[model samples]
Target: MRDVAREAGVALRTVSRVVNGESNVNAEMAGRVHSTIARLGYRPDERARQLRRGSSQTIGAALRGTGGMWEHTAEHTARAAGFMTLAASTEDDPALYAQVIESLCQRRVDGLMVEPIGAATPYLVAEVEAGLPVVAVDRPLEDVPADSVVSDNAGGIRAAVEHLLARGHREIAYIGDSERIYTGRLRAEAFRSCLQEAGLAVEDASVTTGEAGPEMVADALDRMRRCSAPPTALVTGNNVISWQVLRQLGPAIGELAVFCFDSLENAELLAHPVSTVNQDLEGLGRTAVDLLLARLAEPERERQHIILPVSLSIRASSEVPPPPRARRRRAHKAQAPSS
Candidate 1:
């Protein structure tokens, strides 16, 4: 307290007033003291006890977007539980994520909710062990054994493939995000397994993955279309890729059977009623908050890894039969060897 007061050029009582949430201190002075406290990594010795006892009553949420639906739902739930939510965006950058987390830590937040982006997070190991309740949303922490909430990636992909297969899509092509991402890799792998189970071969033209940019998606579509055994149906990895493939297909979107893995807005309103696999974003938020609050209430409880289910909606886009010309090509080529 004395060090903070000395550095902020404020009296000791003012620092105490700021920390204790007492009034009469100027807002500017309070802000300065807060900054100094974060810079000095100042934490009260018994913050663990204070937070568990509901003394500080604040938790930090580090996500991709602070105003997203998941974040908003979480804030509402936390407020209902008598806890204030402090949210920040990670911008999917590792360094920025670290800084935001550090600031949250300096403020001595009771818990943390994060939509992890980076490949690994080593700095969180010590914090978790020190009685900090951390809940990972969407993706699990690479280096820590903390509670996490994630969607069923493999199951969602399987549902998409199964739905397409039942509709007579023998040669189905998949275009999705780069395999470097966790969901991307898992979905791609699941698509391959689906092919093998159906006694179909997995080939490059059948599975394309790269950065999810407009040009990249367009190029992938072109390559798949040019192949000798081009796909009669297409399955996109996520919502963004699904939209890109739709745009790239243009008038041809009506020609190919399409199935999208992640959720898409107004899917039935399109030229062809597009099939989709939708994740429960609201459920994810609610479950994550419930898990975090449970951990806060019982710090010694076992960590939980919860996987929510996804639903697949079948529509005209994916329910259509394979193009006759493409099916004929496959049959003719198969008989050519004996001929």
Candidate 2:
């Protein structure tokens, strides 16, 4: 900054104003300062700027688990954008989520990017109403209207169902997350719609919805396997559920074709790579940051909901052979004519 000021023949205050995008620096002066900054390759100290501004150059990102792949990716992406991040997991608990939000607020974070687990709390609504920039990640609140960055869950599920159908699967099982979450509900609706459109009976007995933990997924897979006529293909709602299903049905995995809503960490390295609908976590993080910063820049701007598209990754686990009925039967010769 000092180098930039010296080069631009401006005082330190003038440089600060230009860098912070503050008015009062005339267009000519601002352009000169910007040119000097570019020539000198001068980078402002974000920490010093935050201290001067009396607000942390930090953004709070609330997620489900600290160690989860998605959370790690989001954190890395946020930090890369010149903002520190305060991360916490709600563990799917409303009270915990509220507590984390309050704690982050006390720290005076500039904005929040949350992967909401439970329904929107009163405090969350109040904070947003009071002009705090809040952008929901992955899942949006049911009752609250706020900016959201999420994937096209319905479209992804529809594509997965279509893939299974194309592979000659009629009895397809769906293991979904609890309907309390927006992603889960949308994916479920899509799965049902695709089945109906294909003129295939959606067997209620084969559709299971609840928490998508490993244990829950294992139980769901077990129940599906025990059905009188087991489904030939399975579609899991999320990555965690997919992992559990794979773990439970390890060696016998080839019997049932599988596709999941989200990709697993080691998906590419797996012995039998599982097909998945991949969500762009880094893109989602960057988009949420963009929205929050935009809101901070212009508070009266109309709220926006951004839905990123998901892509299907076809792999070995989803490539099940056609059923016996679909194969041509061997012709039998009639020996009775000779007799």
RMSD of each: 8.5, 7.5
Reference-based TM-score, model 2:
0.79
TM-score of 1: 0.80
What TM-score against the true fold does each predicted structure earn?
0.80, 0.79
List model 1 lDDT by residue over 47-92, tens digit each: 6547545556887888876776677788888889878898898887
lDDT of 1 at 226: 70
- Give lDDT per model, in order: 0.85, 0.82
Q: For residues 1-339, could you state the per-residue lDDT of candidate 2 as single tens digits? A: 888888899899999999987998889999999999888888988778778887687888777777655556666766777677888888778888888888988788989988888666778788888888998888786566779888999999999989999999887899998887788888888898998899988777678888778777777777775665567899999877788888888887777788988988788788788899999877887788888888888988998988999998999988995466433121112211344
What's the distance in Å from true for residue 95, model 1?
Answer: 1.7
Q: Which candidate number would show the highest lDDT if scored against the true structure?
A: 1
Off by over 4 Å in 2: 1-54, 67-81, 326-339
Choose the strongest candidate by TM-score. 1
Question: By how many angstroms RMSD does model 2 differ from the true structure?
Answer: 7.5
Residue 27 of model 2 has an lDDT of 91
